[model samples]
Target: MSHAQHAVPRRHSGDTVVVLALGLAAMVVSMMQTLVVPVLGIIQSDLEVTTANVSWVTTATLLSAAVFTPLLGRFGDQHGKKPTLVGVLLVMIAGSVLAATTTSLTWLIVGRVMQGAATAIFPLALSVLREEIKPEKLHGAMALVSGTLAFGSGLALVGAGLLTQGSDPDYHRVFWLAVALAVMALAGVLFAVPASRTKTGGRTDWLGAFTLAMLLVLLLLPISQGHEWGWTSGRTLGAFVGAIVMAVVWVITESRVKEPMVDMRMFAHRPVLFTNLAGLLLGFAMFTQFIGVSYLVQMPEDVAGYGFGASVLAASVVYLLPTTLVSLVGAQFGGVLVRRLGARVTLAAGACFGVLGFTWLSAAHDATASVIGAGMVIGLAISFGYASMPALIVASVPAHQTGIANGINSISRSVGSAVASAVITSLLASKTIPLPDGMPALPQESQFTLSFTIAGAAFVLVVAVALVGLKAAHAPRTPVLRKVTQSGTPQSAEVEADAELV
Candidate 1:
């Protein structure tokens, strides 16, 4: 009945292949986000750079991803998803090669910036799934893809540990592994994904894109660096002020643009607004487990009075890996829940699990069994939260707007993570037990308690946001248009749809 409906092909046998290919691509790109965490110290030593300079290997990638992801998503919507996806994979491969081959920190940072463009792959892949998969199967496929992202992050840490083992401990090997995976992903996407027929034909919104980039840079730069550069320092404060100013200008620019990069009005839509908020809170809760548990297991028992002093490899394999593996299971369960209940309820349940998990960790983390149990619970929460987000967003927006909408949602999650990293670091560093004259200080046990409590509170807030804000928002609607496009006018469709897919 509508141009979009006619343009969308019926589900075919190849759809499964497409999902697998795109999921692999999403996993590989997600892996790039955390691959360097276990090896940052080694990279600093090898590159002959200060701790501050070496941190840029991760920081640059963060800033770059924040800048590029939304722009690329918008571009994919305007042009074609398959080509854009393939191009992103190619850039990622090149970046991996450059990082693997180079010894210079500057060159490696450059390579990481290139790799950051791959952040768009997840949202673009979702858009493709919407176009290709049967509606019945879409939720499960998206859940699998989303779960793999969390799985790949943990897998990367384990993979990094294995690759960097032995006295030689070659850090370059990590990037080489990334190169191999990217090549595989590139081939899979090129071969399996069909060319996209749906295109939102519009001129690229360069001004809107630039303003948004500046706003994100201003917001993220301080969040990532505030711990290193004193929080009260001029640079950090100036960046915050600049971000506020830039955000205002961005709002004005977006309102005026005929083809805006992100639709400003979407922020007012109850489902979109609250979904983004819940994403931010869940993102914070997720990172608390990631950074908190990793540091907790590694604390020296004699010095800190509460840890196993685990190595990176042991932490990955023993403590964090099991939880990550469980998350895959949780993701599948979440898909079933979304079909049976709805995204809002699924999200609320996940948030409740988060609150429970973190509360348990905060109270009883003395034994390995307790830590593992809490980790698994949080893992389940993370999987369910991640799975429900895309479903909520995809169900809320039109098919054509899926890419950009999810892109903004992704940015919200990133912002939360950046804040979580900064806040948790600040909290842990706030009060430390003094050691012998030459020994470095260790965080007091109470700091970890405070951190977990704060994270649990954030999850509690998510539960409230979902129940009150999202539930009261407008109901979901089908994307069918009332009338087909005529001449140059755009087709109009009801914004409400049947929310139940199960």
Candidate 2:
């Protein structure tokens, strides 16, 4: 191994403190994403909105987050993460304030769009840490950060349930709590985090941004509304056509632009391409697990589900355990695995776990134990792959491009989820076979069994792509293994004359 490939400086006490704060902030923001779920019924009645319209509160946030995450990530890369984070928190605060006062579904959707800015926090924090933290500490920091996206949201559902129980269900309380947390996070980031090393040099890609925005809107509109609109309707068909045309145009325009929003040339790198392919699959498979298993456990027992008739709190708590627990374990073990087995093996292992877990879920439909086991498998699998993909992407790209590269990777994942949620939900809802006299219209066993099967197939497909398509290409010049004497910064070094001899 090259000396530049050596360990990072020993983490100091302050490093731990800062990482914990980042994790906490990320957790809070993530929790806010789903906190409204338990209170949706109340909000619908209060706002005089249909259940479908109220659903947009969540959908708006997700859509905005998907479309803007790459943009925010690039901004962070160009400017500094600290400022970007402060900006994001401010947006969330504004969103909370707006949501708290909202009396209509339209305003609620607007508030959600504002709040969606917080989703950028996860990627921004990771990008910031890639520069500041040692490689040794990166895994743990990232795991906690990523895991927050799961656990924090789950916890938020629980908290929302507890707070909203009985007496009039003051749903606004959820946003108020989120507002408080956002304020605290902003303060902590301002005090604790340092400025980024990156300096914005190039002109902004306004055209590219416009193109991407149009493309995303076209794509997501169809996905989000296809079921409601009738898939074959002119509106859905028109949107689909527009999305295709916009996407193709984007490719051509981005390739020709001086400062493109997405750096298409990066895809020429094998590992980068492979990582992105894996990301798409991972996103589809992993997200489906959440939706599938939740429905499974909460479905009434008579229909062959776990029959928990689980409240939002009970279901979230039960489902979230595996992700929260395994993420910690995955973070600790990932670095060691990288050191010993290499990044590819670690990633592949995670994919394997996904396949196993989802497959079992498809087969084991009638029991709660089966549901719990499936959750554990899926959680462990995602943590492993999620932890490895970022590391691999970082190792491949230039230092300055890490944030942008990862941003696109993040976009890929989001797009995958957007696609799956659209496609899977459409399929699952398409058929409403008559219920048996004793059972619900759609049997719980049939729904989840099919969902899990679809998810498992997606995972297996990704693994196949990774295994068959990805191989080591020419390695990037390795960094100097030793820490810099001047300020203790990490730096790359030239290979020794005899280094290839080893």
Candidate 3:
């Protein structure tokens, strides 16, 4: 049968179950992305390591995810998404168990590296939805899964807080939680998610994958550690230069290869390019809110004069959690908007909301109400942006390339986030108020103002990218031919019949 002739399966209760299972799995994997944030200090003390050394708990995961996500994604496209997904989950489970059982910092970092493989889960899940779901239900399902990712980051913060509440706390408790979630997700996938029928049969692009991984590592390593190494340090500067050189070689290699790991031509496509660009900016905006709000609220009111002095738990519950929950609703609404208005409009609207939120925080961050309210607005913006991204990608790429395309987009977001972390840390650290005696210095209030202003401007750029760049470039084009029925009436069919038959 022709690809188009394959029966589109009817929607069933089982499909909903699959969506939930996948969404939950995505959420669980996403939680690992930020699960170490709240307990970094505890881990430092417990492991007898410096803050710089301890930071690798998060950095190792970031680097591992950056290196592996695209590779595994392409592997899924070549082999099978379900098996790749299952294998990734099992690895994540082992990672969690290892972390839960280990006290050595090296072992913990290894475990985090294993957990980083979960990054593949997001794109793999997106590919699966495209293959399994009816066309009519795909957008909404994608939205829920995308939104759950953002939701899971916030949920992880809260979970970390709850896990580390006691005076004598163990960081391993958090990994144990990850183990439970991974096991559940593993079972759900094994039982509910069907085997993959969509495959792009080809030899794996080892040379291309290796070059791409090196480029990502060189690029992300500096971004994650630039603050510590000094932005102008030799190591940081050298890595950036090396990454550029590697990228040039990778492009040449990919052009020569039979089946490239990442189609460089896709980057030239206006829709794909602009969508990835927007993903980067939106990712930056989202993390600014995430890391910014969390830090802003935790500043000691007496020392900083601008903070509410909330604990990690308080910040998670009172400030971030509500925003994340609202994002879930916003994602559903965004899915509806995509179905009705289109992805460009939804993306532009989200960027506009983000501008408003960041602008509010920039100008009026004195009160708790204002901070939380701004967070809620940005939360909505995040959901809308996240919901629209995959839809735009899927619309632009062929089904066979869906896994790697989405994977690239995911990496774009990660790069944005890494940049934001470095920028925010530098900005806040640049201007600090000295405290008396033994008290640690605090960032000046102007620093927060400046940071928020920068974020607001970034959102403004997102709006411009969405409205100007995305609209003209990514808009759907008209088909070459019109379909006609036996009655001689034109029908809006996707495919054209042979002229000879007619």
Candidate 4:
């Protein structure tokens, strides 16, 4: 509620326009996470690179986001959101252009690394919502924007499938689409979103940023590559141990710093902490739904002993689109729910939905309707879960801590995604369908059931985190609720006195 927490100025643009601009930017960021999923094979073949080298296309993005999101998010809090957002968007555009034109694996990976930084846009957009939107309408706006993360991720799969459908699949088309999205997002932000009116001006915590970046790199590197590197191997185990050591060092460094990049108290605050735990579980469930369902449907029924014999396009459009649509629609309602029911109830509800959806998926994925319906239900869970994030964050921390607090939350989810990706890959590979000589083996049908079961378990833990850890927290402080002054600013009382939730 402090004056320093300005997202964008309301006087410069309508709330709708500003929200849309941030949402578009966030959507583009989400797309970067999954843009190359369907095109990796083509990218490998066309570039004549080894499978291991081509895989870096995705890993580079994963590691890059882990390193840069927190750094740039804190940078925005210190410098100004407009410049930070503009810088990140420009990087995305340049990266997209590089990726679109690249014929070399090294450059393609470099491009992906640049694109990954756009993930910082989500936290920045949320912080902007905190400063600019009134509390009365803020939860809804945050929910709508947060929902884009899920919708955009799903959209990438469908789009990638269509763009790469024909025999001569042009990998460049995928990056070109990214360029278009980044351009539109950049335009929306530049034209509609106003500059920040307030900033938490301070010295950059370079040491803390470095330590945190190193921690994330140590953690995510293994999760993303553990499948390729044996789980028991020295490199994988050593990275995990190193992450633990770096985490302790990062904490000590932050504690002693003059201007700590992240506030340890805020990082460990119950509501913020548990909300991030919920975020991790949601991330796991989401990837589980996407990777598990996609891989399941694509299995050749006759040869694989179980599956729909679905093509990749059919998998994306028929099975997954319903989920994406629900994430959009459910989010609007989720915003309303967060306002009426509180973040605790909203998150627990989302977890309940996740349990239901995953149970259905595990028990009855024999028919197409069952697959699509289960996914849609899970999408509702994602919508509600995402909607709860800003509410919890805003309520828990001061306005000055908005960007860094949310940045860490974003990192938590990224970590969850990395773990889920590694777990799923290892699980599916653990038990494969037997095959004739020279033919590749498909995953055993039981692996899908097991994956869904494990995902449901993650959600169950989210329910506990929401109900217990977030039992009571403060409400978000807003500016004066009564009157707008002539200068388009609100005449306000003390921010702490106006706290809403309790």
Candidate 5:
């Protein structure tokens, strides 16, 4: 038998079940990450801390998630998938328990950091699904997983708001609930996931992993905290310099290593290179839509904002419709879009949708109608964009590197989200404008207006990249020349032609 046939057969049912469960778990965990946003002010008052310090509750989780996701992806690929997943779930449960029991903000932030490690669940789950699912079903399966990530955040926001708004405002209950979910998810993953039959060999590239970690820190740190740290301060400059040096060192070290942590050579392919670059832009652009819209929906009315004071539940319900509806629509139609227009066309269409959505948002005044309408438009646009981008990444990478490649793609999203937050946060904090005597605070409205407008502009840029640069990006397969050794007349010619086709 050939080597390919001799290889172990896929466990399709078990793999699909594990992926479905992981997708659900990832969705819940993602929602849990942001559940505290609506109640930050209340939590601050009770904990007797400044808003600045309270913000750490959110930032800590994001930072940790971004830093560790790629690490987990690499480890999962090197060792085995199920063990890594179990470890990640255990870490999340520990974090939830710590956060639930702690009254101190310090401990809460610490727990959040630990919980952030679970960020790997989404990418890891995708890697596993890609490995085992039939090629025919892969597209829909990935779409489902991606949609869950987007939709879960919206649901969590609403759920957190509802739980925290009750009498006595139980913020701690949110964390406890997350813990319960994690425990159940752990049990499901352990019981349902099949153990790997593939050989688990080779020592992990510790030095390369460390260097890449430093590289990510260098790249993400300055972008995330530059505004708060003073853009021109030593901290920002040092991070920039450190990122440059580490990146260069990383290149040299990875090149020399027998087993590189990340195979940088993957970028040698034009399709892989440009697809990731576009992914980065899409991330930078689409993430801002959520931030701008969420802020608009929650901001009080006197500030020229929607004044929704819409409890978290109400706002989330509104926010979710766009994502959930579009996701379902996208999953159903993604294959048709791919078959008809190709991945490049689909991405461009998504970006166009984002551009129009953001432009419409920019024109809307701070009203419930505007916020909900904008959410619908932006969510639908992102649905097509998110679902297609990962499929393209999978198509471009080899099976063995699936985990690492997708992990990097996930990192692009994280980086983009951080950039959006930094920009929006600065705009909200620093900008000021005069207001009419009876009108709302001009500064607040102006910030939202400008930020949304800029976000629209960012989406337009993404469209430009998709159209101009990504139009022709596809994998380049080498052509192997073959000759027919037979000395027959027409028969020799036919044999040579057939060999070339192979």
Candidate 6:
């Protein structure tokens, strides 16, 4: 038997606990990413920060995620997943405490930075799932875990809305909620997850990690902030150029390193490449639904000539809650699809659902039931995307490379989301409906239609990626060469085992 077999622990009673733990971790990570979205205004007022400074509350977390995700993912591969997971969760807890207790904007940003490091948890959780679950159950297990991410983000919005709905609410309650969830995740990790069974066992590739971090930060920064910086401004354009340059540097550096942080070929391999592309499009679609619907529903209908006139609380609990519930169901169903059909087919179904969902949302969102029903469809699509993308990664990469491979895929989705945010913000801003006096302008009805149409187009791209990119992936083997270690060894056996797992 190869190392991969040995690394997979014999099944036990504790596996369920571990799965629950991993599920919790996935949800918490997703929640942290969006928890503050609905409460930025409250945060600004409470912290007495300017809009730009308040914006960093989100920006800081995104940047920190870019910095830490790759590094810790590599670290988990080198050192130990359990330790890395514990350390990250602890840092997140500390960060949550600081944010909950502090009144200072700088400290809050710092706390957010700390919380952001926990983004590593998702990849690490994936690595654990790869190691601990039996092959027969692996796809469904991963799909289920990935599915949590969908409900998690929506739950964050609803939870935040609820916490702040009271007459006198504290913004700190948000972080407190984060604190409680992180602690629960930590407990699950401590008791349920086994010790790391496989370590790549090598010297850390600090150079590759640094270059990749720089590349991601540079690449994601402008995507996330271009609207604020003015897309045509030198700052925005400069960051894009810098990101491209850094990409070249990082690629070159990875190729030369003795023990590269990532094997470049793993990235270009058809299944991996297309899976990441699908991830990007799905990510964009997910956020497009989120921002587009949230913004659309919240506009005061009586005043703006459109929208549901929903409050923040109503938007989360009423307009968007069904999507959250349906996503969990979709994720379970996605696992069935992956197990019975294939990740490729599962992804195609998701993409098709996305197209249909957005079409529904775009053409007939005038009624409450129509909007809610459309959101559930989109939510189902997102759950399927989450469920299948990682399964594709698992089938392609060796066990030791799981952390970094999934980490890169995770970043791909983040990039998609950042771009979606910028695009949606720009689209909404570009056209405004005429409002009566003393009313802030609302996005014109046509912009929402245009946004949904564009998002549906992105899913159309995913259908191509799923069908074409993953077409022959079911054949004998992954096309990329194995990542060679300093010992000049190739993990051919591991790859064969991985394909079997799929």
lDDT tens per residue, model 3, 263-344? 8876566777888998899888899899998899999887777799999999998999988998988899988877777778
The reply for model 1, stretches above 4 Å from the true place, is: 1-8, 476-498
Best by TM-score: 1
RMSD of each: 2.6, 5.3, 4.8, 3.7, 6.2, 2.7
Clashing pairs in 5: 301-307
Clash pairs detected, candidate 6: none
Cα RMSD of predicted structure 4: 3.7
Q: Report residue 36 deviation for candidate 4 (angstroms).
A: 0.5
Q: Write the residue-wise lDDT of candidate 4 on 62-140 in tens digits.
A: 8899889988888887777888999999999999999999899989999999999999998889878777776677888
lDDT per residue as tens, model 2, 1-502:
2212332343334666567778777787567666886688888888887866877887787778766777787777666678888898898889889998877778878989999878778778777666666555665666566656556756777778778877678898888888887888888788877666554446667788778878877887777777777889999999999999998998899999977767776655677787888888887886687666665567666544345677666776776556556654665565456445655667777788889988887887567778788778787777777767776676665545566677667767766776677777776675555666875465435665677788888888767755665545225323312222232334442112111111
Tell me the lDDT of model 2 at 252: 91
Candidate achieving the largest lDDT: 1
Estimated TM-score for each candidate: 0.95, 0.87, 0.93, 0.94, 0.87, 0.94
Off by over 4 Å in 2: 1-13, 303-306, 433-444, 473-502
Q: What is candidate 3's TM-score against the reference? A: 0.93
What is candidate 2's CA lDDT for residue 8? Answer: 38
Q: Write the per-residue lDDT of candidate 1 for residues 31-55, one digit (tens) a residue.
A: 8888999999999988788988998
lDDT of 1 at 5: 39
lDDT of 5 at 21: 80
lDDT tens digits, residues 1-502, model 5? Answer: 1112222556677656866787776676566556677778777988999866887887787778767887787777767677888999999999999999999999999999899888888777777776566555666667677777777776666667767866678678888878877888898778877765332246778898788878888877778777768889999999989999998998899899987767776644555666676666666666676666666666666555344655456666776446556654664465456545666677778778777877777887456676667667777667777667767666655444567777777777777777888888788777644556775443466787788788777777777766776654552422211111221112232222222211
Pairs of residues at least 3 apart in sequence or in different chains that clash in candidate 3: none
Which residue pairs in candidate 1 collide?
476-497, 477-496, 477-497, 478-497
Question: Which residue segments of model 3 deviate by more than 4 Å?
Answer: 1-13, 474-502
